[model samples]
Target: MFDFDEMESQNLFLYLSLLVLSITFFFQNIKPRLGRFFQPSLETRAKAAILSRQEVAQFLDSPIVKEQEQEQEEGISPSSTFDFDPYMETKVELVNKALDEAIPVGEPLKIHEAMRYAVLAAGKRVRPILCLASCELVGGEENAAMPAACAVEMIHTMSLIKDDLPCMDNDDLRRGKPTTHKVYGEGVAILSGGALLSLAFEHMTTAEVSSEKMVWAVRELARSIGTRGLVAGQAKDISSEGLDLDEVGLEHLEFIHVHKTAVLLETAAVLGAIIGGGSNEEVERVRKFARCIGLLFQVVDDILDETKSSEELGKTAGKDQLVGKLTYPKLMGLEKSKEFVKRLTKDACEHLQGFSKEKVAPLVALTNFIANRNR
Candidate 1:
């Protein structure tokens, strides 16, 4: 009379159905909706629509969007809205002043100029600002972060110089100007990058930060830029060329990017925390935040390469595809890649929720900006 077998089968079927329904619901929510006999139930459709509307509303309410609207009202483009000119102007002035003092007069004028050129080049010093912002978020002084910020910038510049070399990306232009190699000779370019790398350590070692903190910072920086970090990623990236990458292959690409691009950025955030005298736990949390933002940054960069012009992006567009390098857009398709970016941005922002909103505003704004940047 109990019909126990029947009951068990019924429960199993229910669970399986729920699982299928959930999968369907997830796809329907992320993908474009189409009216079909297989369409979700009315309640599911309504929920999906509501979720979509909420996401749109969130995008509209984002500070980046608000700023974009304000700029547009004043006849400025959205891309130009996040103007780095003022920030760059200050950073350049400070960096150049420091370089002048650091480099003795008549000391290999070309090397000095090349160092200055690589450091003072026009780009949004986003990574350095990220370092400062992370420090501030943990109640650290911006002045305390200056040396770390400069070191972060120097490492970043060194990476770029190396990336643009003929052995790597062979990029001819950066920041809308001729690349370091093009402006300077190939040998000089290589030396400039090497000098920048050395100077990053020099700055860190000589900075007034505590000896213990300096050791940690130096070790982390070395780890990030060495085999376990950017160089390893670059090696994998080079190996990926002309290969038909599956999902696993794509993951390798992601790993490569996480190291090649994200590690330095994440390290910057962690270093800021270290310099701020933050606890290890706090530094790791910032590292998580950086990982999310870094991946999102690369995803957005890939998307922009597919959809934007070189003129707008300030470098070669579609080079990833041209070189057969795996990318989010390549593996996930443009629409899904965009959805992935959105998810990553949301996750990145969620990580910052524990921090003060004021101190975290730039980080939040930056994730959104990276997710949506067309160029």
Candidate 2:
């Protein structure tokens, strides 16, 4: 009571010192715990952002993002920068040249001419490209699978020739030109198809691969084109003609497409992987990938036929609808068919996981090409 002001000042200094000590202690010890408690950790933050830390890392490390970044640095359009077009063009030219060399204008002019015309037409060469891509996906050179690729293409061309005959789809146009039957009468067309079919096996034998792999590939191709494969699908398609959706449902339609289209594609990829010396697991994985792509190709074909004109498709469009073919569009709505395409594309890409990103790029691009192709 006698020294009230001095006592009050002492008390204030004491309180200030206590407060400073408490703040320093909190900063030194409690701040980290509080920050961790209040703020999410990196993994937790990744989870909050709808991705795992691993997924985030993968996204950061993906080749596509890196490629896009590189392209941007080079002042190129990221949307169109992949160079897949040039890659495909180069492969197509290689396959085309090999095909020309394989089937020269030799004796038996009419049949040879028909085979060359059908095989050498302006086609997309998707099967051969798939074959070559699969070969490369398994640490093999593209040239190693050239013979097998050419054989697959020859078989594909044979199918097209047969499919366009008067006894089948009876189409007058193919690959933006006259159908094989239209250009060279049905009799010659049929003979040429048979010749190509035989030649495919013969040409495949020329591949400088192991005899075991060659035998496996040959058996696969034969099975794919036989009653269990394309023939089965074509038979179902022909039988289901003019039938209502109730009569032949999506299952039947899938059977047809799987056999008619997917089987050959599956064989092509499997052959490439086999001939390329890929392990059994790799070959099977490639088989699954190609199967999805094969179905996707047909689904897109159906959608294009329904939506685009012949000029756009470079073939007879709307023919499936006219014939009441059990197409994806015919059974399911267009939107659903498109959704199916997305699912197939995703599934196809999923099978390519174990392969190197750089090696698998062409196959991945080819998958997208088939899905998005207008023709």
Candidate 3:
């Protein structure tokens, strides 16, 4: 006899074992390969659009910025008066002027001003500039990227305004000036921040970019600011109070920072690259660079909070410690944290291989700026 029942059971057991083995193989090897294959591998991605260090140094050594820096050395802050030669200075003035003109007047204007105040109050406009520069690096027109840049700034500003609300950081000062709630009253401040949030979408929808690009930009912005990004990160930060986290716990803290800060930055870079007509690979490369730098930026910010003064920082100092927030410096010690920043910056820059030196300068400068900034 064939022993039909026994045979059937044996065959079924064999099939089940094979199925489990297949799944195990997929997870162990095939899955990771598929993930990397579908998305570009970090190693295979193109370099960023930026200038070489020598070229950048030469450019900085040029008469224009040199004269401005010399004036500062001579005890005159160039920004104190306003000089139009250096591209950075000129860009700042242009952004500030646009912000002023864009804000309206009236009952609603009170909130508008508070929103603008948070943005226009003066700090490095690194994010917006990165957006613009990335666009140019990929051969896109600077004008084409301006709206996206502006929208990013608005989104960032709105987040700051909300982050400082009483329910959040409860901060009273920003950039050495009264916070939106302090200056405009809490209700007006909240409204202003809300207005800015809406305005970001408004700017995106109406901007010169294509409908497809606009959609992506809007989606990225929303993702960065919504539950999965800044808000989620903030929630985690608040929940982490007074808990001495281990390495894994600290990683969660890093996750919060990356979501809170890096996602938008990475989005800005990706948007610029896409608008500039960069290859998909190129765009991915810059996105990775942005992610690395974004994390570096936050780590540097934490370190500066410990080392720099409120006067220099233009905001409350030591608030990270006050809030019992886990920071790289707090967890890793100052020197190790600095080393980490350098390594991160190096990793970011390394991803920019094959990119034009002209396009890469801002990226490199950005890394150094974040790593070395005192404020």
Candidate 4:
């Protein structure tokens, strides 16, 4: 039997849990609302909804933020700001080392080479860094998060390779060099991408956390790339290729961005929180925070594509416009897109209101990075 009553009961329970999480925030900031949504992962019983506008002027401009601002202006505790450069450099180095060690240039040389060539390519390593930061935010050891961090990067690299194949975006340059399919044959790129995807699951299984956490992280990474996550978003985007720009509205755009970009970031934070042994509440908080920034990341990319030159972006610029693909900038002009980015980052900042300011400095910095990065 399907047990419809039990399912309804579970859904009601989830809604109540979400209400509990938001009650305090709702009191201070009535502008933003939260909900409960099912996450398509074995590890996630449910994921919190994204925030609506939270009236940043009312919330972030509180007495506490004003006091901090005064302190910064007076040169008292100027270092209160997060040191994003050094933090990113350290996390990237550690993640690169782990990725290199995980894949060796050994037997079956061609395939291994293809995998390494793409996996070791230049990029921000943002997903892995976010994973490590999320772990440390919850007082977990970096080593405990390393395996999952590496897994996220592996999966991301695999997506890049797949996206660049002839049948897909058909791009020639990624990271300022030829894409995987451009250098290696299409057959090799496909096989190598699959190999990296498989390795992500295998490598995640080696996390130093408890077996339970490891299993949770593994399921998260898989779901992030499967039908309900990145693939789902990409499928929708492809289907929308021929639709008129006016026909694609905010709802569809949000859907594509949420599933395609936000899901990986969501899984990264959730996995980190899991390995760090965060309480269910803390994990859900970080997941909600990451979801906003993940969407911000794509919105910024859309803006950059319209505003910057190809040389500045290190790849094709205005490519989204060329393909008639739907983008935030296209759907809502540059000014509105910029406003949307601000709303999202402010909402992201709101999720960390209960965490230690010191512990969440990196996430705060990441929100700024997403808002301001030129490339």
Q: Of the candidates shown, which would achieve the greatest lDDT relative to the real structure?
A: 2
- Model 3 ranges off by over 4 Å: 1-85
- Each prediction's RMSD over C-alphas, in Å, is 16.0, 20.5, 11.9, 10.8
lDDT of each: 0.71, 0.81, 0.71, 0.78
Q: What is candidate 3's lDDT per residue for 220-335, written digit by digit as tens?
A: 66777777677776787788766675533445666677777777787788778877767767877788788888888898998999998888898899998998888878776776
Look at candidate 4 and give me any clashing residue pairs: none
Where does candidate 2 stray beyond 4 Å? 1-82
User: Candidates' TM-scores?
Assistant: 0.73, 0.78, 0.76, 0.81
| TM-score comparison, 1 vs 4, better candidate | 4
For model 4, the run of ten residues with the poorest summed lDDT: 69-78
Off by over 4 Å in 1: 1-106
- Candidate 4 TM-score over all chains jointly: 0.81
Model 3: what TM-score?
Answer: 0.76
Q: On residues 1-375, what C-alpha lDDT tens digit does candidate 4 reach at each position?
A: 899999999999999999987986786555321111233342232222422434434532334321221111121121365688898888889999999999989877888999999989878888898898899889999998998898898888888888888787778888777888878899999999999999888888888776656655666677788886889888888888767975866767877878888889878888898898898789888988888888889999999999998778877788778878899878877776777776677767877777766778887787787778999
Task: Give the better candidate number (1 or 2) by TM-score.
Answer: 2
TM-score, model 1 to reference? 0.73
